[model samples]
Target: MDWNCKNYHTLDFELKKYFGEKAIKLSINGGFTCPNRDGSINTCGCIFCSEKGSGDFAGNVDNSINNQINEQIKFLSNKWKSNTYIAYFQSFTNTYDSVINLEKKYTQALNCPNIKGLAIATRPDCINENIAKLLSSYNDRTYLWVELGLQTIHKNSSDFIRRGYDLDVFNNAISMLKKYNIRVVVHLILGLPNESNHDILESVQYVCTKGIWGIKLHLLHVLKNTDLANYYYENNMKLYTQEEYINLVCDCIEIMPQDVVIHRLTGDGKRSELIAPEWSLHKLKVLSAIDIELRKRNSYQGLKFNQEQK
Candidate 1:
C-alpha cells in the first residue's frame, strides 16, 4: 500500500507546493506575555499551560529572535539540510506587544537570509485593525500565517481551561486576518476534561465552515508542575489511551476538508515535563498508528465531509 496519504493534505506537501522546496519551521520565542497571565484578564494563565508558556520545544527566550533563528538553523542544517525556513513565533501571545515592537521583531526575522516566511502564534483578543494591517503589509514580501490558539469551542471546556476569549472573538480574528489575505491556522485540543467526543467533532466542523488555511490538532497533555497536574493528582483525571487517541484522530481527519492542511496530528510534550499519557513520548509510534488505522478503514481526509456543513 502507498504510505503517502492520498485523502488529506499534509503541511509538508503544502510547503513544497508553495515554496517549491522543503521548508522547515524554526521555533522562535519572542519573549512575549499573554493577557491571561499579565493581569489584563487573569493571573493563573491556562490550566494546562507550562511555565515556559508553551515554548518548551522552542528556542531559548533570553536569546534575541535573530540569534534564536540562527542557532536553530545551524542545528537543523545537520538534520534537514533545507535552506528555506519559517520563523515560527511559538511562545506566549506573539502579538501582545505594541505595533512598533511587533514590527521590529517580525522585520528582524524577515531580514534573515534563510528565512522564507513568518508564523506568529497569538490569541484572538490580542489582534486588532492596526496589528492586522501591520501583518498584512508583509503579504507581498513573504508568507505570513497567523496562528490562533482555540483549544476547543465548547464553552465549558473554554472556561475550564481559562481561555479568556469567546468563540465570537475567534471568529472576528479570522475575519480580520482573511481581510488582509493572511493565512490562519487554528490550534485545537482533543480529550479536554469533561468534553464529549461530539464536542470535539463539532469544533472541527466549525473550523471547516470558516475560511481558514490550516489546523493543528493536539492531544491534551498533562505536564508537571501545572494546575492540570495538580488536578490530575487530586481528582484522578483520565487521559485517552494510545489506541483510543489514534481512533479519534483518524475520525477527525476523515471529517476535515482536503484543502485544510493538517499541520499536526498529536502533541509533543517534553519528557521532563510530561506528567500523564506517557505514550505521547513515542511520537513516531503515534503517527504510524494513525496512518495504519486510516489504511485499515480505507478512508482519507474529507471522507465524511459535507459541503452543506460549511
Candidate 2:
C-alpha cells in the first residue's frame, strides 16, 4: 500500500509523499516522429516498438495538447478534487521534431489551466543543448522531468534489442540535462530476450551511477505486428510469468541505487495486440504480488547495492 521501498520510490507514492496530495501524469502524443523509424538512424524502429509507435494505448492524435491536459484533469479532479498533473509527451520521439514545434506544443500544455508540470519521453540521441535550454525555461514554473529510454546498458544486449543508440548517447544526454538542472527519469526494460540476470543487474547498476532523478523499470512485452511478435511466433522468444517477473523486479530494485525514483514497476500492455506476457494483463496484481514478497523478505531497493557502483 505504501510506495516507498528502501532503494526506490514509486512516482505516485513519491509525489503524494512530497506534495501531500494525489498526482497523475496526463499522457500526450505531440505529433512527433522518430529518426530511427524515419530512416535517419535505422529503418525498422526499435525491436519492441509497436506499429503505432508505443503510445497508441494513450490519448488520440486529434486531442490537442491543451485538450488532452484538460480532459485528463477533468477526469482526475472529479475523483481526487485537489490532484495535480504532469503533461507526459509519451508517444514517439517527443524531442526529435523541430524545436519550434516542440515549444509550441509544450507551451500549450504548460499554459493549460490545470497542469502542474511536464514529462517528456525521448531517445537519448535526441537531446541537445538547445533542447536542454528549452526544458530549463519552464523549470521555474513547472516540475520538468525527462525520460530517456535506456533499455539495457550492455552493448550486445542493446544491439539485440535494436535500441538504435549506445551507452555513450545516454551519458551525453544525462550530462547535458544535468548542466541545466533538468531532472531525468530513465526507462529500462527488464526481461529482454537474451539478457541474463547478470546483464539485467549490471544495467541497473550502470543507470544508478548516472545520477538520474527517477527510473521506470519495465518488463519487455511482445505486442502484435512488431518484430518481437514474429520472434514469439517463431519460438524465438519468451515472456516472464508473474512469479518470475516479480523476482526479477525485486532483485533489480534491491540492487538499484537508493536515491532513484521508481516511476513504474511494470508496463501497461495493449490487451488487443499483446501476444505473450499474459500476466501483464493484471498489472495491479503483479505489483501487489511484488510488494508482498518484498515485505516478506524485509528487502528493499539498494538493500545490497551501493551508489559507487561501477
Candidate 3:
C-alpha cells in the first residue's frame, strides 16, 4: 500500500485498503468509567487523566448510545461523504463492566445504522476470557479491534504513572485476545517522565512482538486538572519539542512491522486544558513535518525494524 504517498501504513490507508472509502471514527461515550478511578485500583486515574475520563472529544454521556451515534452521523455526514464509521468507545475503561453489560453497550452502537465496526478501548487488567470471547464473536460479524492502554512496558515508568497494572497483566491480556483471533491495538506514549529514547523504543519493540494489528503512538499531552499537571510544575517537567517528537515517531514507525497499522502518531486535547508543548497545538503542521522528515531521511515504516532483536 502506498499509504497516502507517505512513509507508513496509516489507519486511513488501511481503511481505504479494506473498505475502498474513508471510514470516519465516531467517538462514543458509553457512560463508562475506569476501574483505576472507581476505587478498584485507586480513586485517582492515570496522572495525565482528564476530568472527562480521557474522552475529551467523545459524544455526550447524557444522550442514549443510539442518539449519540445518530447525532455524530448527522454532524459528520455534511463534512465527509463516506457512510462508513467505526464506533470508538474511547472513554475510560470501556470493558470494566460485566460481560452481560459489555454485550449490551457494544450491541447498542453496532446496531446503529451506518456504524460499520467497533473500537473498544480499555485497560489490560480488565480483560478476561469472557470479554475476549464476546469481542471475538463480534469480530466475526464486523471490522473490530480493542485498544489497550499499555503506556510503557517499563514497570518503573508504569508505577510512576500509577497505571495500576503490571506488564504481565498486559502480556496475558494480549495472549487471551490473540487466542480468540481478535484484532488488538496497543497505545504507547512517547516522552514519559524520566524515560530515555532507548527506553521508549524498547517499549515499542516489546509491544510490536505481541502481534498487534494496529498501534497508536500518542505524544504525551500534559493536561490541566491532573496529577501530571501539578507534577509538571512542581518537578519542572520538560516535554518534547516538535522536532524531537517527530523524529521519535519516525523512529518508532520505521521499527514497527510493516503490516501494523499506525492508528495515531500524535494526540490532541482541548487547547485551553493543554499546558505545554504549545507547538503540538498545530496538529496539521506536526503531522506534515512527520511526512517531510521521513522523506528527508529516505526512510519508511519497518525500514529499521529488527523483529529478532531483544
Candidate 4:
C-alpha cells in the first residue's frame, strides 16, 4: 500500500516500521530551566519563546513525572488509542542539569507503563561528555532520541533571536551524541526576523551535512508577551502567509535527504497566546494546504537533494 505521505519520510511511518504499531509522543514538563534564561548564558530567553518555555502543551511542571505521564496517557488515549508511547521531555533545556538528576528523571519516565522510548529536547550548549554518557546508557534499554534546537544557521538571525550559542556548539553536541549511536533531531524555524527563503533552505542544506535522524520545521508565529510580539508591533515585522509557508516547507522537504524523518511540518501554537500569522492556529488546514501544494507540484521529499553537497 502506498503511504499518504509518499514523498516525505514521515515520523509516523518510521515509528510504525520500528515499533510495528502506532506510537504517540507524550509531552512531559521536567521543570527544567534554560541557560539563556538563567543568566548562565543570557538573562532573556529566545525572543519568540513563551513564558511556558516552549512546553505550552506539556503536562504541568508541578505534577510528578509519573503522574504527568499517567494523566497525559489517559488524556491522549481517546485521540491515539495506541499503547506505545515516547516520553518527550519537551519543556526547557532538558540536559542542563547534573547527571544524577537527569538520570533519575529519565529513568522514571522510561519505567512508566507503555513508554517504549525517550525523546529529550534540549539546547546544544548544554550537552557534554558526562550527559552524553548518561543519555547513552538508556540506548541499550529503550529507543532514545536527542532533539536540538538550531533555529537558523545564519549568525545574524541567531544573534537577533538571542540563541545564546554558536553553530559550533550544535556541531559538538551532534558529535558527542553520534559517538554514542544516539539519534539526533534538529528543530528549524522559518520566517525568522531577517532570514530570506534562501537562508531557510541553506539551513536545511546544512542539516544534511550533519548526521541527524529527523527535523522539525516551524513557522515563526508572534505570541503575546514575548519580545517578538513587541518587535512585531514596533518594527512591523513580516510573517509568512499560510500559502507561503506551505510552499516553503515543501521546498525544504525536497532539498532534504529522504532518510531524514520529517518530525513536524508545523507547530501548534496555543491560540490564546498567538498574536501573528493567525492562520497558524488552523494547523490541519495549513497541513492540508501543504499536501495539496506538494501534489500540485508533483513533488516528493528529497527530489532535489544533493548528495555531493553533503
Which model scores highest in lDDT? Answer: 3
Candidate 1, which ten residues in sequence have the lowest lDDT sum? 1-10
- 2 or 4: which has the higher lDDT? 4
What value does the lDDT take at residue 9 in candidate 2? 70
Global lDDT of each candidate: 0.91, 0.83, 0.92, 0.91
lDDT string for model 1 (1-310, tens) is 1214544688888998888889999999898999999999999999999998987889998898889989999999899878799999998999999999999999999999889999999999999999999999987789889899998999999999999999999999999999999999999999998988889999999998997899999999899888989989898888999999999999899898778988999988999999889999999999988988988999988889897877
RMSD to the hidden true structure, all candidates? 1.5, 2.0, 1.1, 1.2
- How high is each candidate's TM-score? 0.98, 0.94, 0.98, 0.98
* Tens-digit lDDT track of model 3 for 1-310: 4778978998999998888899999999998999899999999989999999888989999999999999999999999999899999998999999898999999999999988989999999999998899999999999999999999999899999899999999999999999999889999999898999999999999998889999998889899899999999999998998989999999898899898999988978689889977887889999999999999999999998886852
In model 2, the worst 10-residue window by lDDT is 1-10
Ranking by lDDT: 3, 4, 1, 2
Report the poorest 10 consecutive residues by lDDT, candidate 4: 1-10
Between candidates 1 and 2, the one scoring higher on TM-score is 1
Residue pairs of candidate 2 with colliding backbone atoms:
7-301
Cα TM-score of candidate 2: 0.94
Candidate 1 residue-wise lDDT at 246: 92
Weakest 10 consecutive residues of candidate 3 by summed lDDT: 301-310
How do the residues 90-166 of candidate 4 rate in per-residue lDDT, one tens digit apiece?
99999989999999999999999999999999999999999999999998789999999999999999999999999
